[model samples]
Target: MRILSLILALSFFLSACETVKGVGRDVESAGEAMDDAIND
Candidate 1:
């Protein structure tokens, strides 16, 4: 039972990390686009 709980927690943590990483990538892309528009 404890092992199952640990596995579930780990899975949630990993998924959360991936979600945050995706958001970070989106923000970076937006910033780059804005910078390019300004330079152009």
Candidate 2:
């Protein structure tokens, strides 16, 4: 039971990290696009 709760907590932590990473990547891509447009 303790092990199961630990695993669940770890899973949530990892998932949250992934979600933040995905948002960061999207923001970076959008910034790049804007820079390209400005340069062009």
lDDT of each: 1.00, 1.00
Q: Which stretches of candidate 1 lie over 4 Å from their true place?
A: none
Query: For model 2, how does the per-residue alpha-carbon lDDT over 11-30 read when each residue is reduced to its tens digit?
Result: 99999999999999999999
Show how many residue pairs clash in every candidate, following the order shown.
0, 0
lDDT of 1 by residue, 5-28 (tens): 999999999999999999999999
TM-score of each: 0.95, 0.88
RMSD of 1: 0.4
Model 2 alpha-carbon drift over 4 Å, by segment: none
For model 1, the local distance difference test gives: 1.00
